[model samples]
Structure formats: C-alpha cells, structure tokens
Target chain A: MLRFIDARCMLGERCIIREGDPNTKEAILELMDRCHIEKAIVYHAMARESELPAGNMALIGETAGDDRFIRQWCALPSYFGEYMSAEDFFDAMKQHHVTSMRLLPKTCGYSLRPHSIGKLMDLAAQCHMPVFIDLGTELTTDESYDLCKMYPEVDLVFGNSGYRENRRLGPILEQCPNFYLGTGNYVAHCGIKLFCEYYGAERLIFDTGLPTGSATAAVSLIGYAEISDEEKALIAHGNIERLLGEVRL
Target chain B: MDFRELVYGQKPFEGVFVFDVHGHIGFEQGSQLGPNDGESMVHTMDRMGVDGICVSFSPGIRGAWKRGNDQTKDTCKRLPGRVFGYAVPNPFHAECDLTPYFEEDLGFRGVKIHGNIQGETPENDPRYAHAFELANRLKLPVLFHAWMPYEVDRAADVASRYPDLNVIIGHGGLTFARDRAVAACKRYDNVFCDTAISSAPDGSIEWLVDKVGVEKVLYGSDMSFFDCIHTLGKLALAKLSDTDKEKILGLNAKKIFDL
Candidate 1:
C-alpha cells in the first residue's frame, strides 16, 4: 500500500455538515486508517469558522498525544493586536511542535498582499515552513500567481481545487515554481498524468480535505494515476515529507 | 472482488463488471479538461478496469446541437461497446429531434439534459418535454444535470410524468441536494442517482445506499471532467458490503442501461 500524508485536514466542529460526512475527529481517523493515510497535517475548524486563537490552541489540545497528526495552525496578519506578533506566533508554533501554517484571508478579512502579511510571510520564509491556503475561499485562481510572486521564498500549497481550474492553473503552474497544489479534489480525468507530464510530481501535494473531503477518492486518484511508481510515491508522500522535513522550526 | 486489495495493488478491476453512467466528451468552453477525447477516456478506463461508459458531447448542450451529437456518434461508432453515446437536445432549437439518433444502433443508450448550461432552463421545461417523451416511448434512461435541490425536484417531476423512463439525477446523491435526491428516490419508482461529484466526503455513498437502496445508485465518474478512478476506488472501499459495492459499481447500471 502507498503511504499518504494528508496535507489538508480539519478538526473541531463545522457549521454546515451532512448526514454521512466524517465530521468528528474519530470519524476522520477511521477514514485515515481505511485509506492508509499515516499522518495528516491538520487545522481546527473553530480557527477558521469562529475564533482563530482558540481554534489554534484547540488543535494543540486535540492532537496532544496523537503523533499521527502533524500540527498546523491558522494565521492572521495581527495588524490590530488581534493575535500574536509574528515572532511570538512562530515561537508558540515551535513550542507546540507546529510545522506548517494555514491562511484564511477571506475568512479573517485580511489581504494576501505583502503589505498585509509581510511579517508572517517573512517569518515563514526564514523558517522554511510551508504556508497553506485554499484556492477558492482564501483567494482566487488568478491570485495564486500573485501570491507566489509576492512570497517567492516561502512555499505556498493551495488546496480544495475542483476540476474546472486547469485553464486558469496552467499559466500559474508554468510561471510559479513555488506554487504547489493539493490533489484531494483535483479530479479532472488524466489530470494527474497531464500535471505530472508538464510540471512534474514535486509540485503536487497529496491531501484529503478531510472531515468534509473524501479520503477514499483522494487516494484512488493517485494510486490509479497512469504515472510511474516514482511519480506516485512523490505525490502520495514523498513531496510532502520533503516539504515538512525542511521546516526549521 | 477484493476491491481493497485491487486498490492497494493499483490493479485494474478485472473480472468485475464496471460501467459509468455519467460522462462527457469534447471540449468544455468554461474550463480546460484533461484528455477529454474518446481514446483518452478509454485508456483511463483500461487502466481502471471499467467495462463501459456512456458519454455526451459536452459542447452540444450549449453550442450547435447537431455537430455536438455527431461528434458523440462518431466516438461511439469508433469505440463500439466500450463507449456509448447520450443524445443531447438543444432546448432553444424548436426543431430538435433526438428520435433519429435512437433509430439506429449507433450505441446511443440514453438522453442527456444539461439545462443549466442551456440558459438555466428547468429540468422539466416544456422544451425538454419532446426529448422526455421520446425517452419514455423507448424506455430509455434520461440523465439530468441535477446538482441543486430545485434541479432534483425538477428531475423528480419528470420521473412522475414519465413513469417508464428512468431519471438519473447526476451529481445529486452526495451534493447539497442529497436529501432531496433521497426523497425523490423514495417517492418515485424510476428515480435514481449517480456518484459523479468530486467533493463529497467518505461514507457518503454508504449513506446514500442506506437512504435509498443500492439498487437506486449507479456509478458515474464524470470522466474527462473528472477521473473515474477516484469514484471507483470510493465504491470499492466504501463501508457497504461487497454485494452492494458490485451493484453500485456496474450491476445496477447494467440493469438500467440493459447492457
């Protein structure tokens, strides 16, 4: 079985949920076990939905004894003393063993421009911690290119892509070497093969937008992709391992 | 079928009958799709062990209808049993007649109504009545792009009107309209749903099967627009019994399409 490290997952309760969704942490773990995903880079729902600081702290409490979850925290620009300073946030992350950060520009009512997040991006670049965000919610497909250009040194991994993003993503893939995409919902036919052919597997990150996203479907896309075994390894776990391995904090 | 082992081994689903009920070919005007041609789709199917797929020319629902359908006809002709065609009707074209497509054994198994892209026309709009009537006469399946609650209702209305023809609500089972889709499946005998969406979570298929028996569910990959492998794997590893898995994967479609 190909081992997977989910780059995107959430804990805590969500506002809108369906009957069969894996909304709870235990349900998410059951899905991870079934899908052979060994570890997931996880965030808390409260951070994104209700409160950022409490949600981040809640994530620490939730995944306390569980080594299966690689900790990730939601970030704010902290312009109005709403959150910790960039230095203090990174210090807290290092203390808490958090290796990555997630951005919620639209959800938090902030901008992605360097002017708004320059300090956080600078700190992220210094530590080599990958910054994660969603495609449609945090920003538009067109703005991904701009995000990559603005934070050239910091690696940006965008998740929650649908099938209809290739026309917009093609140019971004070509121009932005720092931009990586989450493969959870990027289910376009032969999409993985075509992406591997053009951009190579290094830029593709394996993720299941878990609790809401399908871990079964996400793993199947990579396992059944018409690419070589080496490419599959890279997408399934190799690239993310490499990305997280480089984290200084 | 040892579906889990097959997925772990990354092997094709040999020895199992797998047929996709929702698919699209040709180009998408709104976005770029990967390998949308018949040959490319077949190559993916070959890798995944899918026995057959029914596709509609995506562009036909919006642009010139005849050319779009001719494209489907040509693809179905070239591919034979492996590829089947869905005859699409242009709602704007008053003279549109899908009867000719069904007259021949050109592998046209059903009708596709994607009214949302066709000026947001209702699924049971009067313009689609003609095609629905023909499908009813032939006892064929009519697949509707019903992704919303209202769209599911419209499709259910069609099922009420045409008791003979099966109405497969595409992308409705695991979407926001799932409750509506389940209600319709319970309310109408001919109403069914396909697993064609990209964003539904795990256990969704199991839930659908629980709400409306596995018989009402069919495997639909939305290939070319989305890969078949993901949805296929989802069914294989779903919490349902192997028998239910088989039924949803292909057996159900086999009975519906008369394959």
Candidate 2:
C-alpha cells in the first residue's frame, strides 16, 4: 500500500458543513485510517473561517500529543497589529512545533505582494518552510504565478485545483519550479501521468483536502493513475515528507 | 469484487463491470484537458480496467452541431464497445436532428444536453424538445449538464414531461444543487443523479445514496474533464455495501444505457 500524508486538511468545526462531511478531528482521523493516510499536515478551521490567531493556537492544542498530524498554522501578514509580528509568529511556531504555514490572503484580507507579506516571506525563506494556499479561493492562477516569483525560496503548494485548470496551469508549471500542486482535487483524466511526463513527480504533493475534501477520491486518483510506482510514491508521500523535512523552524 | 481492497492495493478493478455514464471527448475550447480523445480515454480505461464509457463531443455542445456530433460518431466508430457516444444537440441550430446517430447502432447510447454551454440554454428549453422527443420515443437516457438548482429543476421538468426517457442530471448529485437533485429523484421515477464534479466531499455521495436510494445514483466520472479513478475509488471505499457499489459503478448505468 502507498503511504499518504495529506498536505491540505483542516482541523476543528467550520460553518456551512454538509451532512456527512468529516468535520470533527476524530471523524477526520477515521477517514485518514480508512484511506491509509498515516499523517496529515493540518490547519485549524477557525483560522481559515473566523479567527486566525485563536484558530492557530487551537490547532496546537488540538494536535498536542498526536504525532500523526503534522501541525500547520494559518499565516497573516503582520503589516497591521492584528496578529503577532512575523518574528513572534515564527517564534511561536518553533515553540509549538508547527512546521508549515497556510496563507488565507483573500479570507484574511491581506495582499500577497512583497510589500505586505515580505517579512513573513523572508522568514519563511530563511527557514525554507513550505507555504500552503488554495488556488481558487485564496488566489487565482495568474496570481499564483506572481506568488511563486515573489517568494521563490518558499515552496508554495496550491490545493483545490479543478479538472479544467490545465491551460492556466501549464504555463505556470513550466515557469514556476517552486510551485507544487496538491493532488486532492486535481482529478483531470490522466492528468497525473501527463503532469509527470511534462513536470517531474517531485512537484506534486499528496493531499486529501479533508473535511470539505474527499480523502477516498484523493487517494484513488494517485493510486489508480497510469503513472509509474516511483512517481506514485513521490506524489503519495515521498514529496510531502521531503518538504516537511526541509522546514528549519 | 472487494472494492476496498482494490483501492487499498492500488489495483485496477478488472473483474467488476465498470461503465461510466458521463464523459467528454475532443479538445475543450475554454480550458486545457488531459488527452481528450477516444483512444486516450480507452488507454486510461484499459489501465484502470473500466469496461466502457459514454462520451459526447465537448466542443460540439457549443459549436457546430453537425461537426461536433460527427466527431463523437468518429470516436465511437474508432473504439467500438469500449467507447460509447452521446449525441449532443445544439439549441441554436433549429435544423438539429439527432435521429441519424440513434437510427443506426453507431454505439450511441444516449443524448447529451449541455444547455448551459450552448449559450446558457435552459435544460428544458423548447429547442431541446426534439432530442427529448427522440429519447422519449426510444426510451434512451438523456444526460444533462445540470450543476445548479435551476438547472436541476429544468432537467426534472424534462423528466416529468417525458417519463419514458431517463434524465441523468450530470454533476447535480454533489454540487450545491444536490438537495434539488435529490428532491427530483424522489419525485420523479425517471430522474436520476450522476456522481460527477471534482470538488465533492467524501460523505456527500453516501448522503446522496441515503437521501435518494442507491438505484437512483449512477457513477459519472466527468472523465476527460476529471479522472474516472477518483470517483471509482470513492464509490469503492464508500460506506455502502458491495451490491450498492456494484450498482453505482456499472450495474445501474448498464440498465439505464441498456448496454
């Protein structure tokens, strides 16, 4: 069985959940076990949906003793005094053992430009921590290109990719080497194989986008893809393990 | 078939009768796609052990009616049993006639009505009445790209109008319009939902099955647009019985498409 480490997952309850979605942490774990996902790099629902600081702290409390969940905190540009400064946030992250960061620029009402998020980007660059963000909701494909260019040092993993993004994604994938894609919703027919042909498998990260995302479908995409087993391993777990392993903080 | 084992083992479902109801072929004008041709789809199917797939010319839904359908016909002709055709109807073209594809067993299983792409045409628009009439007469399945609640309602209207034909509301099962799709399935015997869409949550399918019984749900990959493996895996590992999984994967589609 191919081991999986879900790169994009949310912890805690969120508003507007459907009937049978894995909303609770326990439910998410059950799905993880079912899908054979050993670890999931997760952030807090409250951080993305409502409060960033409180939700980020809540994530630390939620995954306290569980090594299965590699913790990721929601990041906000500290231009305003709304949250902790970039330095303090990194300090807190190191203090709490949160290895990665998730950006909610659209939801948090922050700019992705160098001026707004430069300090955080610099800190991330200094540490080589992978920055996580959603494609459609947090930013557009064009903006993702700009983000990769803006912070070339920080590896950006964009999730929530639809099947129709190949046209926009092709140029970006060719241009941005730092850009990595989450395999949760990028279910284009033979997309994984074609992507492996053009772009190497090291760029694709295995993710379920759980709670709102489908772990079952996500695993099946990589599992049944017409790609080589080595490529499958790179996408399923190898790539994510390498990315998380590179975090200096 | 030990569906869960297949998923966990990362093995193709060789023994199970897998047939996809919703599919698209030909290059998409709006976005880039992975190998949107008949042979490429068949190659993927072979790798995944999918028995058959029903596809429509994606560009045909919006562009020239004759050429688009001709493309589908050509593809169907190229791959006989593995690739089935869905004759698309262009709402703008008044002289549209889908009878020729149906008249001959050109591997055309059903009629595809993607009204949303054909200039936002309503699913139950009068222009589609011809195709609907043909499907109604032949007791064929008419697949509609109904993603919204309004679209689902319009499809439900078509189901009500032509009770003989089966209306498969593509992508409506897991979209925001799921409740509407479920309601339609409950109300109308002929109206059914396809498990398409790339962004649906895991349990949404189970909820859909719970709301509208397993018989009402058919496995739709939206293949060539989306990969069939994910949806197939979803059904396999779904918190449902093997019989139900078998039904959604191909059994229901087999009966509906009369394969």
Model 2 residue runs over 4 Å out of place are none
Question: How does model 1 score by TM-score?
Answer: 0.99
lDDT of 1 by residue, A111-152 (tens): 888889999999999999999999998899999999999999
Compose the digit string of candidate 2's lDDT tens values, residues A154-215. Answer: 89999988878988999999999999999888888888888899998999999988888899
> Against the true structure, what is every candidate's RMSD?
0.9, 1.2
Report lDDT (Cα) of residue B54, candidate 1.
Answer: 99
In model 1 chain B, the worst 10-residue window by lDDT is B1-10
Each model's DockQ score: 0.89, 0.88
Going through the candidates in order, what is chain B's TM-score?
A: 0.99, 0.98
The residue-by-residue lDDT of candidate 2 on B1-259, one tens digit each, is 7999988987888888999999999988888888889998898898888999999988888788899899988888889999998998888878989999987799999999888777898889998899999999999999999889999999999999999999999999899899999999999999999998888888888999999999999988998888888798898999999989998989999888989
Q: Please give the C-alpha DockQ score of model 1.
A: 0.89
